[model samples]
Target: MASTVSIGNGYGQLLRTRGAWTYLLPGFAARQPFAMLTISIVLLVQHTTGSYGAAGAVAAVTGVSMALFAPWSGRLADRHGQRAVLIPGVLGHTASGLTLTALALAHAPLWALFAAAVPTGASVPHIGPMVRARWGVTLKGSPLLTTAAAFESVTDELTFVVGPLLATALCTTVNPAAGLVTEASLTLLGGLLFAARKSTQPPVAAAGHARVEHASALRVPGVRVLIVAFLGIGSVFGGMQVSLAAFTESLGEPGLNGVLYGTFAAGNMLSGLVCGALAWRTAPQQRLVVGYGALALTASGLWAAHSVLVLAGLGLLVGMCIAPALITGYTLVESLVPAGARTEAFTWLTGAVALGQAAAVTAAGQLEDHLWGGSGFLVPMGGTLLALATLLALRSRLAVRPRSRTVARGVGHRVPVAVD
Candidate 1:
């Protein structure tokens, strides 16, 4: 509790430097509630239709829509902004949700799946990365942005962990249709609030260089490398969810599954908060390396724990490192990126995470089919992830080229690096 307080104080001080904390509050509140609703929508659709196939189609279409259009949508956000870009995206999602409820209830198929998911695809994600970039631009050199990233990670973990559970409760206890309606209303309301705010608008790129700038942003070596890293990390974490499911069921403690998962999440939350609070001297690059290295180490440690309790505890410890690392990674994307690409940059970060998580879950499930149980399944799985993380960390210098190296050649002064 003391540590949490300390962290909050540190974060508050950092935000004070910008004097724009209030400006971001509305966006933050709006974002998390919408995420909860999105998850609920998936669960509700599955329940109402009584077909996992229909449900899966919805999830797939929604996911694919985001992956395909995220970069471009982000580009739009960067160009047109919160009012023009984000609001339209939000409106699309809201209208789609309303229409989909009717179409789904009517038993529409095929093209309807695409139609229903289009709006969910088009909307900007919860404002985590964009907010970080805005802070980076407005409060240049202040640590407030990193602290905000930490806070964003906290909300992310919480929203994901709590969201499905809340959905399940609503569907099972109340009318399933009501649950869907609740989800729709929340998403529409929250997103509208987010776009309506003035400060929520992201920073602008310099004049006459928007299109050329967006293209060049992709060409950035640092961006490409970071994306690769995101893929590996996201895949592993995503797969771990699947692995956990297999492990609990195989251990003949299916009831313990939720408990184990809860602990895993608790660990992530604790670690993220603690790490974010620590006033570190390490460069963001070094912090990023340390962050991944911690995950790799924890992966192996998790494999070694013999019981659920021990594993849960270690998972929490490992999770502590996750948010700070993510914060560092997002900061890297924000710093090296040009002004025009902030929206796109944030989306790329999230999309990378989404891609990795999706791949990991699929691969893990396949691997589990060939294994005895989850315990047997996760060992090899953890090993693979740990090895990859280690390799990436070792080669990070090559993969993540710091800006300072260039500064040394061009100027005598040390160039600032924002990653750790």
Candidate 2:
């Protein structure tokens, strides 16, 4: 628990954080479209190639490349601030995407295609990492932290919900490569917007290098555990990306793919809103465990839904857990990490999830194509269940056990974290 002053159960503390919301607007706008581009790239390539395995390979390459670069990018951002790092990254992403799009249209060779994937992965800015790092710095232990996190989560879910559907429509009904053009243009615009703002500047340490407390955050046990947890989270998302769309098409209802995806995203957005509105009332670890449990149950229940309507409703229920777990994990990072390493900490968390999503998509892409598309969803569901089980088992290991930590803080008494 934050052990901080409690306002009456509303997130009034968040609402009162005057300058907070506006600073985030540009970021939300930029990310909303970028997140959609990820799906657009994945589905467009998969559909165009008629090979899920090929699509997964490309996605995997993207994930691996991005994951490899993410930590270093964060470190650079921390050292040089957002302008120095993000602008170049945004340009890099735009150039790379445009090059690849042009090359694809020209019917380029496979070698160039694979080469282009490297930039595609490398140029993708570490937005989640940077945004969260900014939140950690500005909000400290306030409700603004929770709200910012929830806000990001909602944007994340909503972006995927709306972004993909729009991209899909453009690809199917308009131009097969229309989404690529949009992705590139938005990357430039968003990256430029992020760079334009003076107030939203990222922090840099005195050392002028983001190395001081950086490595230590990586070594934290809980951090590692949480990172591992997101592996399943990534798989869930990856599976959903391919399978949900494919399943709808398989059922001879290709149009419903958009509805299903939108519904799933809606579920996540709704939950993020609900979770954000609730006052912080539970321990981060406890909240995380419960969130994963609910997520697992939702994932499992999704498998048994008998119809699209039932599936959509159940998917919404499952999506509800997305933001809460992330919010809880982020809080834990802030609670446990040294201030100096916050950027790196945030980077690892976001990058790790990205990597997981990439890996899941790569790992399961073939299976979905060769076997049952619905079968792919099982991978994520299983991963979420396993993640839930691991979290439960690690409870004793990670839990603060009231007396031990509270005794350290010497807070004499414990306060109930109120909801409602």
Candidate 3:
């Protein structure tokens, strides 16, 4: 009877955690644009410019810009609060998307497309980090925080799954610009809805506060290690995306790319949901190591896949480790950073992933152009292996425990205790 009760409680944690679903749903909506933007840009640019190299360059530039700005954006949110930072950011990002779409439809110059892409990327609202920060504030000191992290990871996987499929369908059916337009609309609408929820927003830190005296989250001992590891993981995602697209085109079925990528995310979503529900005694670092190992093992199989079916099957296995790893990483970040720095900390992590992805995408694009077929898979394989190595090397530093104190001194308020 005790075991049954514990199992039921574990699965019911998400529902039991008040306001989790409320914030999480809009967060999921806001994040759809992130998943859709890359593919949409690629399709739009490729169609207009008639060169995969140019398309890849534009996508890489956009990713790099977003990565470069994410931590700064997060810092602003930390100081000024979510609505203050996100509302303007979302508006600028949406406007940039509209500009890009117009440029693409008008058959503008390559330089014009690249020019418009900068603001689109720079204005990305770092919604993922903000959402996770809210979770930290809401569920502090509870075991259920882990479950919330898992749910967020599943939300990410689901968004990536749906976003890509939706973008592909729009691009294929309506027009190349349709996906970008849709992405802009979603970003504007969802960002406003998410920001309007005043009850759930985490409080801003006071200006010139001494709590902000501590150096950035980058200086936190374990954070740099996790950021580096996440960079590697991001490379795996970026490389896989480019490689899979190229692989499908080579197979004479370019449309299958979205379905194959969605299948990958589907595997991630399934594992994340299951991992979140079960109670685990293992330390997050141990789980992280195991996750990286799984990713490396599965990703290495890509080199051997000669058939589309085999590649799709391998994609599912490779993706299974993604959510578990990401969930563990974010949970660790929550435990490590001070309350005042949580949003910035999470954004830095997001930026690391973007940096890794940008680098890998550029490299994979080049490899696809020059190397033999399927050789591009090596980029992600190498990245996962590097991530595994980093985790193993820094295992000791990441051993910090979750703080149990309830007062959120950094945010100048108390996080309400979760009531069953």
Predicted structure with the largest TM-score when compared to the true one = 3
Q: If ranked by lDDT, best first, what sequence of candidates would result?
A: 3, 2, 1
Question: Against the hidden true structure, what lDDT does model 1 obtain?
Answer: 0.57
Q: Which ten residues in a row have the lowest lDDT in candidate 1?
A: 402-411
Give per-model TM-scores.
0.75, 0.86, 0.91
lDDT of 1 by residue, 130-167 (tens): 56556656666665666766766776666555544455
Q: How far does residue 387 in candidate 2 sit from its true spot (Å)?
A: 2.0
lDDT of 2 at 71: 73
lDDT of each: 0.57, 0.69, 0.80
lDDT of 2 by residue, 1-420 (tens): 434344334355654565556555656656643456556666667666776677677766777777777777877776678778888888888888877677666767656756887888887876666677766766766647767777667767777787778777776677767877787787778767877765756556665333433344565557677877776777777777777766776788866877787887787888777777766667778889988888887887665565788878877777777768877777777665556556767777777777877877766777777775566677678878878888887765455432211112123543221110
Worst 10 residues of 2 by lDDT: 402-411
| Number of the predicted model whose lDDT against the real structure is largest | 3
- After TM-score superposition, the amount by which residue 6's alpha carbon in candidate 2 deviates from its true location, in angstroms, is 12
Question: Of 1 and 2, which scores higher on TM-score?
Answer: 2
- For model 2, what is the error of residue 348's alpha carbon versus the real structure, in angstroms, after optimal superposition? 1.6
